[model samples]
Target: MVIAIGFEGSANKIGIGIIRDGEVLANVRKTYITPPGSGFLPKETAEHHRNQVLGLIREALDVSKIYPNEIDVVCYTKGPGMAPPLLAVAIVARTIAQLWNKPILGVNHCIGHIEMGRLITGAQNPTVLYVSGGNTQVIAYSNKRYRIFGETIDIAIGNCLDRFARVIKISNDPSPGYNIEQLAKKGKKYYTLPYAVKGMDVSFSGILSEIGRKALPQKATKKRKLDQEDVNELPSHEDLCYSLQETIFAMLVEITERAMAHCGSNEVLIVGGVGCNERLQEMMGIMCEERGAKLFATDERFCIDNGIMIAHAGYEMFRTGTRMKWNDATITQRFRTDEVEINWEVGKV
Candidate 1:
């Protein structure tokens, strides 16, 4: 069996995986935490990646009980991420590949998520809802391409969650998304947040701004401010969280249902970090069941960002002779899934 080492440095996390014949033998992930009171700063993210990537790769190899020389191929995330972080991963993969005298393959980060979902779920031609910190879209396979049928016109759902978490001073926690999800579960959907969708594309910035406006008091006079104690008791934080989730997830479901109708595909698969959202999954499950469509979600291991997806995609590329020169392999923050022609034989489902 040919063993491949996969590297993922798309954003805040550094992940490494070892795969043999498309089977993930080991998956190691390293998360980079920002400083106190800081968000995902590009420079800080890159610097953190430089520190943890090597260790992540080592951990993967160690967990898999495979030496570096045993690997036949090296795969690294190529793009659609922060430039510095992507470059950091590439440098590590390139150096390792050169040292090991193995072929290096670059994989698209978004496609990796979809492909990994496909692998884990054994879904062929499933409509994909790829939601992450950087992206939110409904994708489907047609005419030999993963086409984007629906997406956010402005900020992605994950970004919206991050911003909301920041506003509530919970963005720097161990898992802001998880914290928001927990809070959202606690309260009823009281305030009706805006649900904006144009054609198949949804917009969250307007909804976010609207929620901020509603959350802020109309009057801030000294006398009114003196009633801050009572003011705080008025609006329920959990209610706001619930409403935000309902609006955003309902929009996602609406677009996904529309896409399934347009594409004539009954199967849908959810991928990316935000795909791990329980409420989103439940909503999609209900919609798909009502529409007589199948819905698949990756397990936690496959749901969040990871390196095995890159390795799986790279193996397929390698099998198809999609070799690239050093110059040919460059970072791209706007790479789309439909742009590439994939040969799936190397990646067995």
Candidate 2:
């Protein structure tokens, strides 16, 4: 009965998870609400993390009914996120691990997401479509590593949507994506958006800019104010929403199909924040049905950001003797999934 405590303070969310063996006992999270226009600020996020980590840790431990001294290991997300936030959690976890005479492992964020999908879905050899505010990638497991077959060349899908919402002055109260989806539901995709796909890589800034220009005209002043007024109505919003979802999801389906064709594997798994989108799921389901492939998705628990996945990934790493050197352990904002070297047996597939 190994008690493992996992911490993920990457980007705007702070996650904490407790795992025993392969079971997730408790998962807790805290989100940092960023102001509109300004994105992630490392300094601000770090300050917020410093205050939230202790509380979230205590909550997680209580939920798991595990005492600090009983913990066998403390695992924390090492990188591919904001440096300041990473450092804040790392310092906390490292100190806790040392105090308890327990081993500490530094885990990658992307690998955590990948491993969570594995734990929840029991996917052995599945192609992964990871789309989030920070990342957009199509991955597959091969040779004991999650290989990136295709990804966004510039901005992530979520980022483009968020920026587009901001440009249109949409409400950012609940979530940018949700607001955009709501607006899109009522509006018509009156304008034709660009579909740029260079090989497997995608670019969305062009489409976003184009939409913004039409949604909010510049030189028109009050010339075509009716267009803006019409956009404020529901039908126009729905159409735009439908169009945006259709275009982006279509691109994803196309690339995913290409990856499946290339890898010769029919099983597909979708992960990350955007994976929760109903439209994306429908598109993938329809495409997979046509291609005679299967698409697997994590439920809300494992789909969005959570700490359980971190604990699960950390537990696997610990089991496989994947530990980081004290001095060599460092956080990165650009860690790729394929860079991780795991020792899982290929025959398990």
Model number with the top TM-score? 1
Off by over 4 Å in 1: 35-37, 218-227, 345-349
| Model 2: how far residue 73 lies from native, Å | 1.7
Q: For residues 241-275, could you state the per-residue lDDT of candidate 2 as single tens digits?
A: 66777788889999999999999887888998788
- Local distance difference test values of all predictions, in order: 0.82, 0.80
**Which stretch of 10 consecutive residues in model 1 shows the poorest summed lDDT?**
340-349
Off by over 4 Å in 2: 35-38, 187-190, 220-235, 346-349
Which candidate number maximizes lDDT?
A: 1
